[model samples]
Target chain A: MTHELLPSGIDLLDSALNGGFTKPSNFLLIGTPLSAKKEVGLILLNGGLERDEAAIYISTSNTAEEARSHWEDYGFKEQWEEEGRVKFVDCYSKMLSATVSDTPSIRRVPSILDYTKLSVAVNDWCTSYYLQNTPVRLMLDSLSAFLIYSSLQTVMRFLHIFLGQLRKQNALGFFLLEEGAHEIVTFNQLKTFSNGAIRVNEESNMMQLEGYRHGMNIPLPSAVVPKATAEASQVSCTPTK
Target chain B: MFKSNGQTTKVPTGISIVDTLLDGGMPNGDSFLIRAHPLADPLSMVIEFLHNQLKNGGVGVFLVNNKSPASVLEESAILKMGLRDFKRNGQLFFIDAYSALFGLRSNEAYFVEDPNNPVSVSKVVAQALSECSKKGKVFFVYDSLNTSIDEFGNAILAEANTWKRIAIAFNAILCFIYTEWNYPKDISEAVANLFSSIVDLITLERIVATQVVTVSKNEGTPVSKRMVPIKNAVTGGIKGYVPKILVTGPFHAGKTTLVHTLSTRAVSVQRMGTTVALDFGHVNHRGFTLDLFGTVGQPRFDPILERLGGEALGAILVVDSTKPEEFPRAKEMMHKAGVHGLPYVLAANKQDLPDALSVEEVKKKMNISDEVAIVGTVGTDKVSVVKVLDLLLDKILST
Candidate 1:
């Protein structure tokens, strides 16, 4: 019955987070424009991959090819994909393009409007990893896109079911939303469901950890960014409490 | 005047359940659109098409666009399609449209240098058809028309129209792998109308995800509208995949034991031999993977029953034969679990006990109808539990 927290791959916040995010909980990441929210997601996923855990990247805006290139640009090679340690649920491709093919590591969802199919793809990957007893960490890049495609009520209901499914498999979930894209009411509604949130400030490059026992506001390093990624000196092996 | 022969002039789809659904299969010179979800891969069905074609000595040509021609063959080989041998004997050919998009030089003989031009693609397809589709039931698989349509926009529909005419002229069975990406209604209807039949690869969301194939449209055959749950892999092309099966009854009725006995692998969330949460087990029964979910039989935990019963294909109600008084509770549990109306079989469990009532007595006590199968079983015994499962599976499949 002991709880475990996996690393978030962000070094400065680890000391305050007591290890990282809760072992199996829905996490809200507030991303200001030009913030490294997506990079944090990829790095957090990399943290799980380092532990031999399976990771699912739910890309709402980026195509599978574009997403993989982003992963490559960050430093990871195709080996992780070939090994099936990482998977992508690309919801962007088929919306505009007619003939997009899926690789073993990458799956394509029809569109955000078709949330059921999107949910199904996420469930399949979670269940696959769960059955193998492999811990899973899911990253849904930019929840704002979903809000644009759907009503606020619909997205809330989706998060309720989606985060619940991830919790069922003891999988951690990270959903990033642009800072000013949504109203305060909408943000508060989503925040109420999530175990905690990471508020990022693009102006100051600082992050305020909310809801954790020892949550604190910390100034992020210059190197913890999109271009440099986790490959730089920001890479941390800080163990969870 | 010659009377109707009664013999089918139809060609088998190489899928047993699909063939059954179509009452033998599509007639020659017919086209079937195999629409799939973005997450699902029904390419195996196409591989099975070629595999079956080889057996019947029918020639086939697969148009590749999404992926490389070599990858297509490699995937085919995984589905046990010995296409290399067929290629050696000149019975199989691949229209390498995938390589042309990337400008990669392909070693394929029937390669399309530019897939952007619909006419060039059609000409290549026509030439390949002329070469191999001379005799027997010729097969032409547009590996997927989605890619060509994506590149050429709605203009590819005209090309598809042209191919449809050519397929009929050649008297071939045309199979198109069209993954539905939520296109506009007009375009979707245009695509649907072009085919004589449409087979959709659906993602059925259950406790675990399952892929099911159903014939949505057919011009000739009487559609059964049965969802054939399909599993895809490198080894098995397309096999029967039954994802979720439920086992529920009153407390101490041995529901968990029945699940353990039935599944190849099983685990129970329990405290002191009492299931507190749930029991999960899986068994490959009759070429289909049956996921067994055993609900916590305690009435206090009845709240979890509804969640456990989510999209269960079928259920097996395990009741203690010695305790007929508890039959009402067992029946009530089904309703509480939301699996009361689903295809279910009553397992008169603990039948090995000397004081156990007969199956008929158990049925009478429960006031169950004749259609609801009642099978005598010992919960701990694998054979007994398996018999109960088989009965439930029969009820589900026969649906």
Candidate 2:
């Protein structure tokens, strides 16, 4: 299988992101609670799915069924139910099912280092279906929720190993984060570990996207604004507060 | 038949209307003592009087040195009674005593555990009255003469007497003694000795019930009284015809998302999955605007969100169709809304997938009151979300 950087295929978005996503690069997406960061992740995943790319979803908080239901509004229900390429690895459910507390236990709940135990189980199941089907994209919905099950350091260590496995397979990756990480020390650690980073902020009515990439910076227009040509400068478009 | 004292005398009724209600103006020069409570509406009378004098282009020098001058001015501004055009004409001189009236390091005096020195009180009052008397026909208003009694002790009466002597000497200065009527016996006696007997015009501020009755007293003189009914506008905060919709339920019940879907704009202080705090949104429906608050499902949340809705609400209890177990929590919110007699609607949200419970199943899980109108919804769909509000309207209209 050949590894290729994935394009969301949304022309404006692809241009803003500098010719689409870079393979094996971990990108950080930050936004106000309801500023639509998760929605962007779902949109990108859906675009990949449309291209027939097998995607793996790792949920730290929500259940697989819940995530599936949320994306139904974005037109992913039928595509997901039909092909099992879009699957969920629910850590929350697994921990609950095993009745093992990451804390107060004789043995600490396994961190990302222990993710191999899970991936091995996943690898075995995938082999039963098809031996060599490599996932094209992997998304960790949120890391903050995972901290509830394990310490930030433990989770980060686990993520380093788990994400290394995805990078070895050349899978595109992105992490969804809440704005509260502005105070947490772990967010900076993630930023240092990632190749690129983007921040989303909603000022009044429009969502603004800004980021630094490879020493070059890109400033995207409001999430819902259209770029106009120089000739159309007479016709101005800006959201009014 | 009284001796012709060569002094021009005027008394402040502390009210503009009563001043107008008393014709062109009252006597100026001599002090007219007004007795009333600290919270008494003496301000309304004083402002209306000043407003009338102001509207007539009657330029008068006013000396005010209250720490809360801004708030007092704001209250007067809202009443539309005092010195509306005084600032524009640049005639109202405000004396902020925040830095110098007291003998302390600064005029920033909050409470007086011990009474103040009479000398300092006399100096501030003397300075204020002298400035107010500079222009001949000036309506000299000393807001509350008694405030200084705590700091000035009985020396305030001597100061008032000295003020009387100066006005007699000027023959054009008008002195008005403004203070709470039922003051401490000592202070009242001291103030009375200086201004009461010499008062040419007396206006008794009467608040009998909500009605304001002004009685102008004279010794063996014909009675001249005026009664005005004061109507209060909406106090505390601005209220409108907009309906308040409170969205609340168990954790992960989609209440915040439902509000965002319904509102034109939204603000949520959320963490990862569950709401660590509250969410807010403003929705303008057909002709009504709704202020929506999505509170956390905890029991302590009731008081904060309840006050946010003020009087009543048009609440919506959001439920996740996929999570029937959360229905009991939603019902508890419904009961609280019922206590306010606020009409509410149930939003059976997340009804897009096969795993989601049907509307009938959700209704059975919740303690659906006869008052609530339940509707199935997909919050992500704008049109479907508006339909839930439509049901809320029908519920409100029926109730």
For model 2, how does the per-residue alpha-carbon lDDT over A84-195 read when each residue is reduced to its tens digit? 6666655544323333322210111122212323443333323323334544666677766655433555456556655654555566776787877445577777777676
In model 2, where do residues sit more than 4 Å from their true spots?
A1-3, A94-135, A182-184, A204-241, B1-399
How does each model score on lDDT?
Answer: 0.76, 0.53
Displacement of residue B331 (Cα, Å) in model 1 is: 2.1
Per-model DockQ: 0.08, 0.01
Best by TM-score: 1
Per-residue alpha-carbon lDDT of model 2 for B1-399, expressed as tens digits? 012233423443434334443342354444455443332334445555555555654444343333233433554555655453575565554443322332323322122212234555456545654655564344555554544543345666676677666665554334443543244577655565555322222212221112233434322132355333232332311112233567777777777778888888999987676676788888766544567777787666666655554434467778889987777766766666442367777788889978998888887777566656778888778887788888876665344
Tens-place lDDT digits, model 1, residues A118-140 = 76678888888877888888889
TM-score, candidate number 2? 0.31
Instruction: Please give the distance, in angstroms, between residue B62's alpha carbon in candidate 2 and its true position after superposition.
Output: 87
Candidate 2 chain A worst ten-residue window by lDDT: A104-113
> What TM-score, to 2 decimals, does candidate 1 have?
0.66
Docking class of 2: incorrect
